[model samples]
Target: MLSAGFIVAVVFSWIYDITPGGIIRTEPLPKQKLPLINKKVKTYRFTTFVSVIIIIGLLSFNIIDSASARKIEKIDKTIAVLPFTDILPIKYESIVFDYIGNQITAGLSKIDDFNVLPWRSTKNFRKGNKDYVKMGDEMDATILVDWKAIEIEGEKRLTIEMIVAEDEKILWSNDYSIKNSWTEISVISTEISRNIARRLRTFLSLEERARINEIPGSPTALYNAYRGRSIAQNALYLYEMGNRKTDLSDFDVAIDLYTQAIQVDSSFAEAYANRAVTRLWGIYTTHYSGNELEKCLEDIEKAKSIDSNLIEADIAMGFYYYYGKRGFDNALKYFQQALEKDPANVDCLFYLSLVHRRKGNWDEVAELSSQALENDPASALFYINIGTSYDYLHDFEKAIECHNLAIAILPEWPA
Candidate 1:
């Protein structure tokens, strides 16, 4: 006969059901993925790069910069370009500033030398004023770019500054006037990105220079894409700032932002996918009505039909299957497809782990969660999944230890 403790362990294990991926992102896995159930996940995980210096960070998208980011690995190489602020006389011209700010970020992302933090990730740092040097250290950024625009009586003034990451020294500064059309904005932004890259690398390759100069042949399409990206970027900013609230306010605002993007460019497939995912999150987490869920599904289908190769489209379909429709089999397929394209996507990995758990594959759960943890070690949910798997295996000691680690990260109960 089985011992009383063994029976109790099995009973308690079945009673455990904790969900991950709230504010700080997480993925799931089965028990076998974890080498030892009690082993703590490693932090300071780096993005895939050939350089010896690892980027010691996530973006400042989180409401608060984490105190646990002990050291910034490559301060000299990592750069952060904040959204441009407006000191315009006209209030509504602020949208123009948003457009220019996004152009700068998108421009920098194309360069290979620096790890540019996405525009959405810099949203939280837009608070009126702060110490740029301290911000650089907190963000693990070695180069800091700040831009501001002022428009008055028929003249537009633009100022750009680059700060040294170690000490907040302005290495380069320029002030120029925007005397050209809106189309000139992209050209100006690209030149700025190239200037920064050139400063860091000392010389730009032929390809790098070409990429910086490349603009769409049709000026109309170029303008529309930039405008749509700006609006979508704003929605993403709201989403990041929302930081996983239980209410639908954050998701709803993001939906509105994407709606504006679609209005500007009806064929923006990525914007549709973003809306669908945000709506889907609302459907699962908030008290969103069926209409929103239906809209979410519609957006997903529309995005998939529009751009079959979009990774976000695949991720939305996966979320729909797993969380919205409870179709684990289809969810697994879609998520795997998404991960195959964007191998380092932390969200897709965590959601896939959850799907494996539903399929009753504890070993798969361990494997998925473990890999996700390598890229996202601070995720409490990943640790929780590993802990639960050990609990089921009657490794009570390891289980308790894992649970304690999760508690340390987040003191609240995991739902």
Candidate 2:
């Protein structure tokens, strides 16, 4: 329509002249001026009109495209939980920062509509430059959660905000007092997650609400269990980073912490499940001296008896089949079940990818590894696995690209 209107206007102007007296037919130019008139028409009139219309069209398109992008970004539910900034004294930083951040992330991961990136994905933004907009863009997250800790007398308080990643608009903000107990952390984190979900306009299933709200074991036992978990995860990260001695020492300490939690609360299913996995890792790393497999199975059974739907227990069972018995089929089944419960879980996704690789399902391996990387972008193992899958599928270019990404992330480890 616009082009047609422009053409009509051009033809009308060519055929008639508008003047103060009246509209009149355009008279033929004198012979002396004919060349100049022709030159003006040929050199500028046609080309200039078309160029102006084209520029207007292009500008309109860009404006529409940018508006559409902003609209989509506004509704995108992808979230990245940034590390909690601690303003307390040096001795109180890591424990408060890591535990609260991790618990909040776990709580948010239970929401079905939220693509909650794992804590590792946002670890790089903990210190130094704290630009939420840039961080969200780099992580491909539309929502960014920020947290800050302040000490008030003997206790600590946390201020949190869920922001629109594009513009740092606060979608939701709240503050909670932190007590010296795991139950308090659990309750506070769950509340914050629920608020964020509500702001995003997503309803939680009964099962998800129950899972996020579950406060298990005595306060002391829960504290020990979480501390053990933190240690075990750090040790595992170190092991992956080429620290060979991590399994021998740090795993032992983590296992002992879990043991303490179990002693305090005999029915702490999560602690049992965590211990089972840590024990299995010890066996996998060839650092175990006793019957770690038997112990792992016993813990799995104990955890199931305590809470049949415990995801940690299910994940432990999956790893048991994978690491202890090499039963890829069973591992796949258990991991799939866990994945269905917590679709964005990095551990479940990684374990499923590993099982698929063993079962010669290269496509499934690549797909699951890619999903794992979405949650854990900093994990070189996921990139390496993806590269391996591509190599098996004979896509050498993609394989090399993935390998290079892994190498870039961890130059110390040979991709």
Candidate 3:
């Protein structure tokens, strides 16, 4: 009976071990299927975050690049030609004096990166005084060329002095004397121009030289242009100094002079531009109707079409767009285009800053105005713009500083 009972016990144990319920089952722990999460979906989310980061980095880089480009665009350097003095004592030989001056101005203007004051303006200043410092200050000239010619016996002895000035102080002065026959005057003038260009190159950078040399024309065409330019320039001077009410007779004469210049050379861009300027002035200052404005635009467009690179055309167009039509967009476009053609275009930069200020872009106004000041350090207008920009930004200290600088430069302007 004991053996039988043991045997039954062993069989029952075997039966329990073989049963599916009695087997060591895992209790089916809620069938945890890893929360049904997809590995690829998580990978896609991570990849999207990385792509967004890359896109932001690219955008930031573009923004920085654009800012840097604008900053580079603002850099400009300029040089000037002072009035050529005639030391000749012959009163009737004033024509010769003007001839020599015209030659010198023409040669220098042909050199790249030079912002030569027109013969008209220089002649006007020279008519009043011979002080180099005062003339340089009035014209905002960086370099001054003072010339004297004495007719000795039958030969002409010319004395030329190149004076470099900064802040009314002469930095460097060099004197050169040349003796030549009447026929050799052009050769002598060419030599003088070459020497002055060399000296300018020494004082100026390579980029500046490139700018001066970029104008397109043959030597003969350039010389002829200068002749025509001198005529128009002299007329412009007469117009500027003459009063419209008291000098209406002179105005007619000045207009005739300008017309004569165009007759001398139909391709003379400066003459056209200056005539347009004079007409526009009449519209602005006199009883002229809007007809003058339309005619001015037509002449300027003609001038630009003749020579797309004419700086005067660019400036006149910029003025027409900015002040006449009040089209700031077109104004800015022409100004920027002019700047691209000649980085040292002070007028373009000046008006560009003004446009920025009018648009309420204080930072851009400050930047462009400061750049204009650098290009034309003696310009009171630049200082005024700078001060205005600072005032707009509510930086009273800087505004005051700019105002003081402006007053120091041009004490005649009202604060």
Q: Which candidate is the best by TM-score?
A: 2
RMSD of each: 27.0, 13.9, 24.6
Scored against the true structure, residue 92 in model 3 reaches a CA lDDT of 39
Q: Candidate 1's residue-wise lDDT over 1-415, tens digit each?
A: 2234444654555565545743332345577785653323332222222121222122222212232222222345666777665455544555566666667777786676666765544643554666887778766677888887766676776788988867777867877678855445777877787777655544567897787787532333445444544443334333333446434465556567677667756777777877777767666664365467688778888988887888888988898887688889999999999999878677778778788878888788767766765553334555576577667656677667667766655565351
In candidate 3 the C-alpha lDDT for residue 244 amounts to 43
Assess every candidate by TM-score.
0.54, 0.72, 0.52
Query: After superposing candidate 2, which stretches have Cα over 4 Å from the reference?
Result: 1-74, 85-88, 181-183, 201-208, 217-220, 240-247, 359-363, 374-378, 392-394, 404-414
Error of 1 at 279 (Å): 3.1
TM-score head-to-head 2 vs 3, winner: 2
Of the candidates numbered 1 and 2, which has the greater lDDT value? 2
Estimate, for each residue in 1-415, the C-alpha lDDT of model 3 and write its tens digit.
4334545654565455544555642233365654555998899978976875676667667777667656433422233445444454754345556656655665566555556655543553443654655666666666766666666565556666666544343333444444443323445555666676554443445655454444333333434444444443343333433434443333344445566656756776766776676555444444345656787798798898998888788777876776577788887887888888878766677778888888887788878876865654444445666777878888888788777876665465554
Candidate 1, residue 31: the lDDT equals 70
Give the worst 10-residue stretch by lDDT in candidate 1: 48-57
Candidate 3 TM-score, C-alpha based: 0.52
Q: What is the number of residue pairs that collide in model 2?
A: 0
Ranking by TM-score: 2, 1, 3
**Candidate that beats the other on lDDT, 1 or 3, i.e. the better one:** 1
Q: Given candidate 1, what's the lDDT at residue 371?
A: 77
Worst 10 residues of 3 by lDDT: 71-80
